[model samples]
Every structure is written in C-alpha cells, then in structure tokens.
Target: EGLRKAKSRLMEPLMQVDITTPEEYMGDILGDINGRRGMVGDLGERGNIKTISAQVPLANMFQYVSTLRSMSKGRANYSMKLANYDFVPPNVEEELKKGFVLETEED
Candidate 1:
C-alpha cells in the first residue's frame, strides 16, 4: 500500500564527482571507489594532483565526504551534481548484499 506507492514515486539524482589527490593515492582511491560500486569515468592530471572523475550511487555517497577526508589526509577535494541513472554491476551487487545489515532508521 504505502510502501508500494512511495517506492513508485520516490526519486533521486545521480552525481558526477571529481576528486584531486596525489598520484600515489590513485590505487587506494580507485580501490575504495570500486568497493563502493562506483564507476571510474575518467582520469587526468592537473599540476601535482591527479583528477579522477567517477559516477557513484547517491545512497552510498552519504559517508563519502568524511571517508575521503580521512583517506587523503585533507589533500583531496571533490565536487558532485546530478547526472543520470546507470546500471550497477553484478559484482557490486554481490558486495552490497554481503555488506548489508538490517537496521531501522529510528534505531
């Protein structure tokens, strides 16, 4: 009833994020992105920092700000905005299932 109606009407947008960090941290960053089921759309260089463009799920991105801060030791900065829906990979789905835990929002 209500759940079905909400699911049918609820909407969210995809965001494109660009991060700048040291070259040495590329693998670590990419690994984290992959683990989060994110897709690496592009990579480039700008001065001393490596620029990485990735498409990440909005639901999973909630904790990204803090995580990136800790991972880069304050050397990284990112910007994101709405994009479009894309298919999530099979492996990512499996990983999410394994990591999923049943918890109530109120709890």
Candidate 2:
C-alpha cells in the first residue's frame, strides 16, 4: 500500500519550540518537557522570565498547546516551527508501540 511505502521511507518532522515562564516555574516546565521526550536545546533568563528553547518530535507535540496552558496556569507562552526529523529514541518508540487509543481529539 502507499502508506507502507511512506513508512518504509520513514519521514517525520522535528520542531523547535520557545517557551517563556517565570524562573520559579522552570522545574515544572522542564519536567513536563522531559516527560514528552523533548530535549532542551538552550535556556536563559531575561528579567523575571525564563526562556527555554527545545526540539521535540512532532508526534509528541500534538495537543501540547493546551497542556502547557493548563500546566502553567495561563502564565506561559510558546511558539514553535518545523525543523527537521530525527529518529525517535528506542525507549520512546517502544512505549509508543503499546498503541495510543484516543476517544477524541481532546484526549
């Protein structure tokens, strides 16, 4: 099937994201990022806000906007763009293999 051919080629997209929040919130934010299989590429502080830049897989980033908003209590802001795809880590791939069954987009 055409889908099989695409899978054989193994194409995916990477994304770069910028997140801003108070310095006190960095630990919670960093934990969430790591939970989503993201790597922090850079981090810095500007006045009262901490800025973090990261690269994450597109698949793992789905519905991330709402999740971030809820986690930060609407105090955080984020932006992201497509970068390039890279192979997923073996552990993450194994976990995803268990399958994701979502009842709705909100899930």
Candidate 3:
C-alpha cells in the first residue's frame, strides 16, 4: 500500500527558481511572483535577508530579472534552472494564448 501510494509522480512544466532579497523587499518579490502564478516551494530567512524558491512556468519568465530589479529597487538577485515542461497555470496559459506570439526565423 505504501509503495502504491508513492509509485508515481506526475511531471509538470516548471522552472526552478531561487531568489534572494533584502528583508524589506521580500513582500514585493513575493507579490510579483504571485501575479506570475508562481508556486512557492520554500521561503526561509538568511541572516538579515530572505530566500524564496519556486517553480514558475517558462512562459512567464521573460524579462523576469529586470522586472524583479525594478520592484526590489535593484536589491534583489536570483538564479533559475530549467526544470521540466508541464501544464501551465490557467491564467498564464490564457495570457500566452491571447498575446504571446512567437516570431519564427527565416531560413
């Protein structure tokens, strides 16, 4: 029964993210990610600051660092890793469908 319960893990599209920001700007960073439909995996305090780990859709990641910098007053830094592709959040999916167009290269 235990094995059966743990047998499968559904894989979804994700971008592994680690963001570090000054304590005062934590709220802004979190709020920004929330708007992007990011899933917060962890949040912890480090000395006088905070770290946030999350999985966000690649589609929502365009210019993410720049956006964060503006919100955090240039005090935030983050690292991202390509996780895996999976279903996008409904809101993100909707936005992508509505306005995100891909430009093809000419051969």
Candidate number achieving the greatest TM-score relative to the actual structure: 2
Per-residue lDDT of candidate 2, residues 10-61 (tens digit): 4458899899997777898899888877889999988989999998778889
lDDT of 3 by residue, 12-88 (tens): 46789999999999888888888777889999988988999998877678999899889888998999999877765
lDDT over C-alpha atoms for residue 20 of model 3: 92
Which structure is stronger by TM-score: 2 or 3? 2
Q: What is candidate 1's local distance difference test score?
A: 0.77
| Winner by lDDT | 2
Candidate 3 least-lDDT 10 residues: 98-107
> What tens-digit string does per-residue lDDT give for candidate 1 at 20-103?
999888888899888776789999998888999998878778888898888888788889887787655566555554554333
**Predicted structure 2: lDDT:** 0.81
Candidate 3 achieves a global lDDT of 0.79
Output the TM-score of candidate 1.
Answer: 0.69
Backbone clash count, each prediction separately: 0, 0, 3
Better of 1 and 2 by lDDT: 2
lDDT of each: 0.77, 0.81, 0.79
Better of 1 and 3 by TM-score: 3
